[model samples]
Target chain A: MIAVIDYGAGNLRSAVRALQHVGAHLQVTDRAADLEAADAIVLPGVGATRDTMNALQRLELASALPRLIHAGVPFLGICVGMQVLAEQSEEWGLHPCLGIIPGTVRRFPSHVGKIPQIGWNQVMSCAATPLLAGIPDGSAFYFVHSFYVDTLDPLLVAGRTDYGIQFPALLHSGNVAATQFHPEKSGRWGLHLLRNWIRSVT
Target chain B: MLTRRIIPCLDVKAGRVVKGVTFADHIDAGDPVALAALYDREGADELVFYDITASSDERAIMVEVVEQTAAQVFIPLTVGGGIRTVADMYRMLRAGADKVSINTAAVLHPLLINEGAQRFGSQCVVVSIDARRVPRSHPTDPLRWTVFTHTGGAGRATELDAVAWAKQAVELGAGELVINSIDADGTRDGYDLPLLQAIASAVGVPVIASGGAGTLDHILAAVTVGQADAALAASIFHFGTYTIAQAKHFLAEHDVPVRLV
Candidate 1:
């Protein structure tokens, strides 16, 4: 079964609907026991990194996730969920995050088109990973974010997409993978990616 | 690069799609779920489902339709037409809406925009302004467009200028603005280019041009001339005057960046 970690981050319902559409056995909760029992986990979030991190800390999922992910259980984080996995973010001043991944999230510069870069943009696969197995290289995904991750290690990057500067759109290390875009709302390609994630374990 | 969006607005009442979209493959012409699925298949960049239901039971049906539609259609869904409070916004968001467009409530209680934006990121909050051009009271100034809260039904005009309201709402945390022209709505002539341009240039965030879209050229002019990020139309799409594919193709041919499936 897949456990979608819901720590009060917005858009959990849409994530649930997408997973349900793909026929995945999923539960939306922040309980430690649920996270521990699940064979795979999906951490979904929207809104600011500060809010998401605070919710995770309040629910005690912030500390619990590292152990679960370190145990080699399959995991995926979307948007703010992925941003929080970094060491810190520059949104609304310096904020600490999970530090699971070695990176810092920064807002897009003023010169780079728009602030909340909202719309469809093409993502190109950077590395060979199971999460992006069947997905095309130049596939467009629905993106709505002002921040992008600047990773310390390049090997962790799985997919790269350009807005003003080339930022990591998808990242994977062993069993843990995440995307900056909301795959739940990205049409057929999004569903296919979720199916692939489910197919990896089941 | 982020391309311009082509959004199809579905004015839903009760559990049915309003104005009745007569698609050949659809079994029920008024089914919101079926219409949403059809739009998604036709490669629409995004969709807006405005809940125009008046009754309490119909509101429940609207919520159900949003949930069902969100499950089937895998694109960004913005729900509008009855969202008032942050709790109401949460209700729709939890039921599968990516964003909620607050119209009446936004005008009455401006703090609702800040509250909704603070709770569910700025991207999730869209302030839709229904503006109509009136005769200028001042002799020096030429522009005279006032914001309307409930135009056409129980119309209430406010002293707030449309351009000023657009900037103020953004300052209060509205990520995007949907500028709807009351005079040009359903006229099928063209969009209010001056109105759209005034607001679009005033705010840094994205602005969606709504109402008065008749032909493909009107849509093209919205992005090219009016400087809108997205063009939203109702009858032209619902009445089978034009498909989303044709609009995208027209946009692409005219050098407007669009997602063509």
Candidate 2:
């Protein structure tokens, strides 16, 4: 079963429902044991990265997540979930994250049109990954966040999207793959991407 | 590049979708869940469900409507109307709404916008403003509009400057603003371009133009002339006067970048 980590993030229901619709046998759990037993893991989140980190720490899933990813367990992170995979974030203040990916989460500059870039923005694929197999490059995906992942290693960057500056839209490395956009809320292409991820992992 | 959004707003009352002319003379459309699915398939960028129900007892039905619609619709869903507190926002978001839009409550409390944004990020809080143009005293004076609330009867005027309130709401943590014009709502003539332009230019966040959308040109004008990030309409989509695909196609033909399915 795919374990979807639920650590009091906003709009967990939408992620859960979308996963279910895509034919995934998943369990929404806050327990580490569930994550350990699951074949794959999906960490879905909304809101600030600090709040997500705090909740993950409170639930004792913070350390387990990095360990599981290192153990080669297939993993997917959405929005703040993807942000927390970075080493640290500049949102609010300098704070350590899971450190699975050598990167820092940075806020969009004021000239990027909007602070919390909320709408459908195009994601251009950088590499041919299974996560974006059938999905077309430059397809519009629903994005609702203020921060973007600035990875240290450019090879791990699977997709790039532009607002003011080009930012990592999808990150893929070893057993872990993450997306800044909410694939659950991106309609057809979003669902297709989820199905592609599930197929690759399963 | 980010594409301009085309959203279908469903004015739901007592679990059923309804439309009105200037917020009166309601006409039953269809089931919200079915219409939501249809719009999703028709390539609508997003969906907004405004619960127009008056009684608190029927509020539960709106949650159910959101729950059912979210199960089938994969796109972003925004729920507005009757959201008075953080708990009310929580209820809708918990039931699968991506964003909770608060209009009158945000105006009345003002702090509710901050509280909601603090609890669930600014991206989840959408402040909707219902504004009607105030007749100018002299021809030399610039165009002016005031905010209005409680669209149950004739609507109550708040006498707040719509443009100033747009900026203030963003400062108070509104990730987005939906500027709905009462003067042009349901008239099917066109959106109040001056009002939309004023508010859109006033705020940095994405502003969705609501209340007036008659033809495909009107929708296109929203982004091009009105400077809105999104155009929202009810009767046009509900009555099958135009499909979401047609709207996107028209916008794309007119050089406005849109997601075409």
Candidate 3:
């Protein structure tokens, strides 16, 4: 079963429904035991990364998460979930993140048209990965966040999107993959990407 | 580049779609869930379900509609109309709505915008403004518009300027602004370009042009001339006058960036 970590942030129901629709047997839990037992893990989040980190720490899943990811457990992170994989974030002042990936989460500069960057933006594939197998390059995905992950390793970036600066849209390493866009909300292309990730992991 | 979005608005009253949807394959046109799925399949960038129900008792019905629709539809779903408090916004967002739009509630309690943003982040808070053009006293004066509330037959005009309100809403943590022109709504002539341009230029957040979308050209003009981030229409897509695909195609042909299915 795929364990979807629920830290009581934004809408996890949408992510759960989308995963179930794409034919994944998943369980939404705050317990770390579910993460340990699951074949794969999906961490979906919204809202601020600070709040997300707080919730995870409160639930005692923060320490378990990095350990699981490092243990070669297939993992997927969305939005704030993806941001928390970084070393620290600049939103609402500087705060440390999971440090699983060597990166910092920073807000989109004022010149990027909008601060939150809400709406459909194209994600251009930078490297070939199973996460974006059938989805076309330059396909638009639904993005609703103020901050983005700035990875230290350029080789891990699977996709890049440009607002004012080129940012990592998708990150891939050994057993972890993350997307700044909400694939659950990106319609057909979004669903296609989720299906691809599930297939590759399963 | 972020492509201009095309949104299809569904007016839901008592859990059912208000307008007649004439999709050939759809069995129940009044079913909001079925209509949402159909629109999603047609490549609509986003779906907005405006709960037109008045009483609080009927509000639960809209929540069920959102829950059912969110299960089947993969695109971003925004719920609006009758959202009063942060709790009301929470109910919809918890029911799987990606965002909750507030109009009169935001005007009455301006802090509601800030409160919702504080809890759910700015991205989940959409402040919808209904504005009508106010007559200019002097020829030398620029075009002016006033914000209106309770956007139906019982509309009430407020002293607030539409452009100023747009800026204030953003400052109060509104991630997006949906500027709907009351004078141009249902006229099918075109969007209030002047009003849209005024607010779009005033605010730093993404502005969605709503109210008047008659033809495919109007949608194209909204993103290009009106300087809107998205264009929302109800009748055009509901009555089968145009499909979302056709609108995107028209915009793409005119050198406008749009997502085509």
Clashes of each: 1, 0, 0
Candidate 3 docks with a DockQ of 0.85
Give candidate 2's iRMS in Å, 1 decimal.
Answer: 1.0
Scanning candidate 2 chain B in windows of ten residues, the lowest lDDT window is B20-29
Model 3 RMSD vs true structure: 1.2
After aligning candidate 3 to the native by TM-score, how far in Å is the CA of A177 from where it should be?
A: 0.6
DockQ of predictions, in order shown:
0.77, 0.85, 0.85
Where's the lowest-lDDT run of ten residues in candidate 1 chain A? A129-138
Docking class of 1: medium
RMSD to the hidden true structure, all candidates: 1.9, 3.0, 1.2
TM-score of chain A of each: 0.97, 0.98, 0.98
Residue-level lDDT for B231 in candidate 2:
96
Q: Write the per-residue lDDT of candidate 1 for residues B60-165, one digit (tens) a residue.
A: 8888988888878989999998777898898888888889999889999999999998888899999999999987778677776899997637889999999999
Candidate of highest lDDT = 3
**Each model's TM-score, in the order given?**
0.95, 0.96, 0.97
On the 0 to 100 scale, the lDDT of residue B20 in model 3 is: 68
Highest-scoring model, TM-score: 3
Which is the better candidate, 2 or 3, if ranked by lDDT? 3
Q: Which prediction has more favorable TM-score, 2 or 3?
A: 3
Give the number of the best model, judged by DockQ: 2
